[model samples]
Target: MDIEYIKDNYIFEKLNENHNLDDFECEIEDLAKFLKEDAWNQQNMNLSLTHVVICDGIVVGYVSILTDAMKLRILEDKETKDKICSKLNISENNVIPAIKIGRFAIDKRYAHNGLGKHVFRNVMLSILDISENIVGLRFITVDAYATAFGFYVEKHKFKYLKKDQKDVDSLNKIIKIDPERSFSLYKDIKSILK
Candidate 1:
């Protein structure tokens, strides 16, 4: 089966009071907790907005997004910074604006299936549309968890801005347990258009 057919069985919407979020469980406890708890709180606070993917009137997965900025000077890879500047038509030392996926999770029942990718494809499309029309977004960033690092980098082509840098989205606080892992990654929105 292809991703389209799998995606066709699901419906995507912004998180709302009408959502059936009681039984939404993923492998990660924090992710599951966020969906049922922090998602609404964060949304109401204007900190982040969650997008849910539902099937059979039940929430299957979700991704929360928030605005972020990537500092070119902080990136370790000079080549990547140069490419970003050249592609976005900006200076190498400028801070580029971006959208960040603050959290992403798939329900346990939906895990190991292709629904995550399906949901991600739609996200890319939505962000791409927004960037082209409503806003001039240059990148889609994510502070991906250490466990799912390979999936984002290999499957979605998200690249690390710097291997040694701490997670910037943590807002000046340190929550990371592993200093060796660089989970802050980004995908150029322009690259998706191409």
Candidate 2:
């Protein structure tokens, strides 16, 4: 599979409408299931920025950024909201500047080729570039999966905003990645062209 960055609205719409879990491998199927649910769609409907990772010209993974103030507050928990605002040195009522990596999933077939890292790097670069355009953007964040926490911390150097906790004794674990601390992981982005 060839890796390419996709930003077409029509392509993203078609991918979102036609995505199926059955076509991917088991690991990817799990990720797709979460992404395909109504809850996920509804929660991210207000996001204004989106980027899709295409392999062989087919959409396989995506990442989105939300700049909407109301939507940001609605998507975060009280504690997270406070921490985020504080970290960025913004008041509660102030328009909070944030970039959220809403969804990231790689096709099972392409998973073995380090596509996850590729997509993640591309997404980070996209966010950083967007940050330059939006002066208010002070932080980039992501709600990383518990299973992938170790990778984010050890491999990517993403500092944990809070301790790891199990919400329902399930595979899902809620954790945040602070892009400020993990900025070094993106040196490669500077070398690669968009």
Candidate 3:
């Protein structure tokens, strides 16, 4: 498939009544099913904004984003956190402001065709737009599955949030699904655009 043609033709929009979600399918069952079943409801409830990728009127992929708060766990030392706060001109707090990519998946038929990265770039750009309007959202965070760790970390250059055992155990209890493999990665919005 021609990249520009696909990029130009595909429709990216918020999930709405006109969109059909039942037929969406991806290699990952959970991700596909979430889009087909729960995405619209979540959007309707104002929990997340699900952006669907459509080509020739068929749903090819989707991504969801939501305002989120994360702890500054990447900064291990208090001094580091303090310095960052000083640099940002914000008081040090338990939670750091963020925009989370809650769900991201492409249809099975479209896998391995570079559409995922295309859609991801759009997601980041949209986050940048949001950050421009809303202050204090400095980071974009993703809790990537083991299968997607390389794409987010290696390809996208998102930093993994390093944690000690206590933090790991706490995260494990909170995540409760492949916690050992789940990666909490983040990138500064400004850094990404740069």
Better of 1 and 2 by TM-score: 1
Best by lDDT: 1
**Candidate 2 lDDT:** 0.47
lDDT of 3: 0.77
Top TM-score hit: 1
**Every model's TM-score:** 0.83, 0.55, 0.81
Q: Considering summed lDDT, which 10 consecutive residues are worst modelled in model 1?
A: 171-180
Q: Which stretches of candidate 1 lie over 4 Å from their true place?
A: 1-6, 86-90, 165-182
For candidate 1, the lDDT comes to: 0.79
Lowest lDDT sum, 10 consecutive residues, model 3, at 171-180
What is the per-residue lDDT of model 3 for residues 1-194, given as tens digits with 9 covering 90 to 100? 45567777887888888987778887668898788788888988999999899888888889998888767646544554576677867665557789999889988877777888887888888788888986668778888876676678677877766573354445535445653356677877777766
Give a tens-digit lDDT track for model 2, residues 1-194: 44333222213332345444345432634456555553246545653444545544465665555542232344224565577567767665665455565556666656646667755765667667876674556445565555555555455545443222233133232323321122111111123242
Q: Is candidate 1 or candidate 3 better by lDDT?
A: 1
Tens-digit per-residue lDDT, 1-194, candidate 1: 34455478877789999998988897778889988989999999999999898776778789899999888866666777788778778887688889998988888877777788778888888999988889787788887766677678778887776653555455224435653333688887877755
lDDT against the true structure, each candidate: 0.79, 0.47, 0.77
